[model samples]
Target: MDVSKVRKDFHILEKRVRGKPIIYFDSACMALKPKQVIDAVNSYYNDFTACHGRSVHYFSAQTTEKYIEAHRKVERFIGAKENEVVFTKNCTEAINLVANGLKWEKGDRVITTKMEHNSNLIPWMKLAKERGVVHDYVEVDNEGKLDIEDLNAKLETKTKLVSLVYTSNVTGATLNASEVAKICHDAGAMLLLDGAQAVPHMKVDVKKTGVDFLAFSGHKMLGPSGTGALYGRLDLLKGMNQFIVGGETVKNTMLSSWEAEDSPAKFEAGLQDYAGMLGFGAAADYLMRLGMEEVHSYEKKLARKLYDGLKAIPQVTNIYGPSNPEERSALASFTLKGMNPQEVALILDESANIFVRSGMHCCHLYHQDVIHEMHGTIRPSLYIYNTDEELDKFFDALRNIAALA
Candidate 1:
């Protein structure tokens, strides 16, 4: 994949910390933006800093054109129709669109997994609390792999939806979306995939998976923040209710009566992030040019290197993820014996200029209920721009920390 050349595209990689070269290993939280994405966002503010789809002036027209083009680019990126894509502030909002938009009757059931991030879990729990809807979770094995039998057992005729994470943010274990989708559909339930971790690291085709809805953020994929999308089947979206109201979301409004726009526009309300959308489209284009399959292959190679390196260290204990590199994403989460996760993370940053995530990673329920780790695990996430030398440095830092313990 010529990672050295790829590294040149990101300006943030050149940054230094405490007079030493910075080693970034926290792509799961937010990926570093490339110059192409930065330029695309800058051009929007520089040339056409105007409201989209609200005026007929030159700036507005240009902004509107780019905005619609961004939708088209994302549609192509995820193998969805243009009308099916709805832009949201982030992935959390995208998921909430489906959560709040759907009509939930009392006793209606929704199924999820323990491995989901808080963004995916909290909304459904809110539904259960405020409304009369029921929410259930599928079980995962010790390796953080979902139990298909438990998922099947949870599905019932009253099951309204099965929402799950495509990849675990903490453990890096990936779900078989197609299989899960089939199970949900067979039981007369719709499937929604939280693709925040999966979309950035792998090729995801919602059509191939037959999922009713998909949500992901652009910030985790080398794009700007406040940019994300929701892809829903046209038929399903047409039947759902609008989440937010006012502005472009409505077709016509009389004193007390209003008609909402169709599909995508019906969901998007108020002024959108025009600049962020352009950057998101550019980020998708960058990944497409490089090829998603190639990106996935390269990341898996690096993940295996990191996993094996961590395993070799005697102080490293309770490594949490799939043992097989092919079954996991480009990250690993583990805990060092006799050291707090936060302390280890601080040491790595202070001594080696390394950046990583430490904590439950917003999966507190999973950490307490499933893994049973109170403090949490040290997570080192990777991307295409990362190199082998960086992994070597990470291992060296860990070894030094281990000696002190």
Candidate 2:
């Protein structure tokens, strides 16, 4: 799918790391921004730098229109209603908003999985102690697959919410979020999905998934950092309490109390990142032009290549996940015998000019379950900008490292 054209969109690829052309394979951590997103941010600063949803001046109105337009674009991208989308600082903040916004009492249960990033896990854990709620975990199999039976078995009357990661950043295994969402709904629980890794690599329809809530970051999807979104069902958002309150999110204020603004406005307090939101809109437009289906196909092809290449290396061992190409993202997690992951990563960066992430990747609990280490796995996540020639070079480097070991 237009690999050369896609590669040209990201200027970062043109630079050299360690005196060699950069070989970035860390999209799961953060993706490189494209020219369109950059220009969008630049245009905002150059032409319009005014407060949004506050003033009636020309630039202010234009700024407000751009901000609202960005939200509309993001809503369409995930197939959700515009009011359902709430802008946040990042995915971490978005998840916390859900965890904090809910009104809970003693004996209320929140179900989650061990495969979640800390942003998805700790919020519930803290809620358990602070609000007298119960936190339940659905265990994953040794092979990194969700134990759907265990998930069903954990359902109970008091369960309030079910939050899960759409795809594991450590194992590269994708989950059937639609099925999980149905299970949660049947149990009278709202399902909230962490879509950090899934949104960029696959198509997601919040309505089709039956999820009540979903969250993702812009930087993971070719946009700038510090921009994220939380999508909640309109009914739920209407009932949920506000997380932040200020000038933009208040309808009226008395000396002792205040009435909060409407759904999305009540959540987004203070001065928001107008330019970043515009850039995120541009990023969404960019991906939509490439087509999510083509993006998914391209990454799966690369993932298959990576899986096959790693499986054939005698000295390398990969963690359990999707063995077939169909069940994974464009990411690989592995360790080399007789070589520490950190050391291997450093050598790759310093000597071979390769960039890869070699740590827990913010999923320490999942790492403990599989690798039994706190530091976690070495992750090499690919994106559309990567090429088959890059994969071949990666294979050669692995072979050389294997010989040294």
Q: Which candidate ranks first by TM-score, i.e. highest?
A: 1
Scored by lDDT, the top model is 1
Q: Give the alpha carbon lDDT tens digit for every residue of 1-405 in model 1.
A: 889889999988888778889999999999999999999999999998999888999999999999999998888888998699999988999999999999899999999888889999999999999998999988988888889999889999999999988898988988888998998899999999999999998899989889999999999999898889999999999999998898999989999989989978899899888899999999999999999999999998998899889999999998998988678777988999999999999999999999999999999998989899999999999998998999999999999998888
Model 2 pairs whose backbones collide:
none
The alpha-carbon deviation from the true structure for residue 37 of candidate 2, after best TM-score superposition, in angstroms, is 0.1
List ranges where model 1 is wrong by over 4 Å.
none
Residues 44-136, candidate 2, lDDT per residue (tens digit)?
899989999888998999999999999998999999987899999889999999998988889999988888899999999999888889999
Residue 23 in candidate 2, Cα distance off native in Å: 0.7
The TM-score that candidate 1 achieves is: 0.99
- Summing lDDT over every window of 10 consecutive residues in candidate 2, give the lowest-scoring window: 369-378
Candidate 1 C-alpha error for residue 238, in Å: 1.1
